[model samples]
Target: MTTMPAPRRLLTIAVLLALTGLVATGCVRFPAPESPPPTATAGPPVLPGVQVDVPVEPLPSSEACNATLTLRPPAQMPLPRQMPPNSTMAGILERGRLIVGLDIGSNLFSFRDPITGDIQGFDVDIAHEIAGAIFGDDRRVEFQVLSSAQRIDALRDMTVDVVIKTMSITCDRLRDISFSAPYYVASQRILSFRNSNVTGPAQLADKRVCAARGTTSIGRIQAIQPRATIVSTTTWADCLVLMQQGQIDAATTDDAILAGLAAQDPWLRVVGPSLGEEFYGVGIPKGQDDMIRFVNGVLERIRATGRWQEIRDRWLSILDSGYGAPQPYYRD
Candidate 1:
């Protein structure tokens, strides 16, 4: 290779560098320097519109119609395959399956089994009993996943024959749907990090507590602890994630649900006294007197025959929840 003198080599390098700069500015434009990629230093995940300015929804008056008083069951309940002609049970039988609305994420109540992919829980068994009463086979039930807000609408639009989600019986809900006699009575409570020192409502002051929107828990918590800031989540699991991420201080819902959340993470715990009773029922369409009576019959039978106790023991006992089946109440 021929070697150039130092001055000549330096001049050649300068000319090449100048030519490269001119080419970059005049030809390809170098992609306009990339503009830093529209990035942000994110701290935690959150759903949009989750924060809320607590509204004044005073708790529904306790006197708002005996919330648990549902239509009384028939004196002579019909056997499977013997549904009355043109009745709700007959229609369900004709369809060959009972369509149920529930949440798959509601662990211990109706979550999918990790091994088998089947949904089984306390509420699920109650629904199974209804299917057995109508079709002579408990397996003759189809579950449709739904959110808490969609339960009533599902029944109203005939999208589901029943909603076995952990729904509460309240006067406000009673106006929209007829409930089967109270099957499980839950109480609103709080869930927080085990070491968070948030043991009860007293510690909730100024804390951003989360609950699912369109749930009775919101009004109950708001009414009980006006000092705490409340945020709305679309689902209970969202509240759990928010707490896990340290985005929220605590979560409030029925003890049954809080138990499920606590079971998922060892670092979480359920705390506080019951805010109030929340009676869960098999939500039926309003004006479906026969269906309401029939479902109430199923609930009554299960409560008396020890089946309800079996379900309670199987799913909730592991959570240290020894709750008994809620007693039935009849409007008649």
Candidate 2:
């Protein structure tokens, strides 16, 4: 009987053995994901107050549009030493005509008068005042129309005496050229069609933006909306033209420049909070202390004599009549 029962028991044991498996392994540890690159810190705080409008227009695709562009280099090559103190008007007078490198394309900072064919703007007036201080006649200025990229180089090569093209006084720029006390303050802003759904920097996620090349405005836009597609041109006017033609969704630049564009096109307006502080100053070749001092004196005189206010009122009144004239910065 014991021998007979073993056959059935053996079959049941064989079936149990076939159902067991040895494939259970211990838990695994995967490598940690790589950390992302460090991002740049935000820039300095923006200064309070708005700037005067800068006139901008659509770029006409004609030879006449190209004819208005010009580039002039700096007049006096920069020396190795820091700027010398031109503390007295007599010192500047010995040097002769005040050579000024300016942007003739920008409306309020530097632009040509359509009727008189004279280069005029707030900066232009400042340049003429410096000339008058040295030569007793504002007409003694040599105005050189220059692009943003060329302005600093022009100063380095001695092609123009000074640069007054709404040049912002930044630490990087201070390394290359000497700057006078800030005469005007501005901030970066965004310009878009009034009816557009975009309201601020956060909404620019998939938008197309335009800005002038070699300007900080582009950096600001990229910082806020890293995914945005950006287009850069040589001038703000060109950027505005592209925007107007529906080539881009937004144009970003100094608020003053944006205001100028808005004035030219009724459909556009400035949006978003100010990006960063911008202090506009005249750029002098490094080591021209004497010239720097002379220019500072002229800037002070213009503010004191109400000429600065006159220029400010003339250009800014239409956009923001409540804003008072800017205070001159004088470094002794």
Candidate 3:
């Protein structure tokens, strides 16, 4: 090698040393420039292109029974066509029309006729039968469209005489209102898209489920799948709407109601086993034992004479052809 100046030789040695040091280290490593922690999104989860907020209501207290429990009506109801004097029936008759509180959107239980513009369904038929007994005609009644949350209040405010919506008879509700004998028995069930892999409530983990706000179905859904995101709406119709929009993973309520929704849409189907027992009873104002008795009597007549079966055949035959009226359970 040719001789070099002292300063040049020192610079060359320094550069070689630096290169050797770099080679000693296997590869230049950095502490994975710390990734920014994931940020959470604001507001409740919203469906793409939808403005509605999937409101989450507080889960009912555990003191609320999770079991399938129902109140038993009197053991024996008055015979059909027999109304006690000064009873609720008298007041309703005096009013000229039985002001019945119900939602007109329930597909199977109560829905409006497209051509006739008359409300009709299983629940509507039940109300009509009661009206017929009082006035010999079912049409002598006024149908007040009440949301699910408004049913009890309407009865308490005396705005409506009775609620024939798909009201479930529950222990908590019993404290605030009276109910006739269980006219129809339906279990809490899941209604989901036909293509969904979820077979039942258990599969609802991490899923979004919709139920009518202020109804028993919401509580039951929480009990069955605490991990599920419950979206409580104002009506079962709303639940159906959300499901149709793909905003919810499922709609949960009485199988009867689910059957109604499923009937309207072939893509939707009711799945899952009975999460809890649901007793469909007519909701009456508190301290209205006379009304309870009168309504129970009407229920007995329908169940006895096969009119209940007829209504089921008419409105719910699509779900179960062999369906029969639920036997009344009387506590007294």
RMSD of each: 6.3, 19.6, 15.5
TM-scores vs. true structure, each candidate? 0.85, 0.69, 0.76
The lDDT, on a scale of 0 to 1, for candidate 3 is 0.77
TM-score top scorer: 1
Off-target runs (Cα >4 Å) in candidate 2 are 1-96, 321-332
Please provide, for model 2 over 131-231, each residue's C-alpha lDDT reduced to its tens digit, 9 standing for 90 to 100. 76656677887888777768889988978888888887665666577777666767777888999987788878878787765565665567667777777
Instruction: Give the Å shift of residue 321 in candidate 3.
Output: 7.5
Error of 3 at 199 (Å): 0.9
**What is the full ranking by TM-score, best candidate first?**
1, 3, 2
Could you give me the TM-score of model 2 versus the true structure?
A: 0.69
Candidate with the larger TM-score of 2 and 3:
3
What is the per-residue lDDT of model 3 for residues 119-186, given as tens digits with 9 covering 90 to 100?
88889989888898777767898989998889888988889889999887776777677778778877
- Steric clash pairs (candidate 3): 73-330, 73-331
User: What clash count goes with each model?
Assistant: 0, 24, 2
How far out, in Å, is residue 246 in model 3? 1.7
lDDT of 2 at 128: 76
Considering TM-score, which of the candidate structures 1 and 2 is the better prediction for this target? 1
Model 1, 294: alpha-carbon shift in Å?
Answer: 0.9
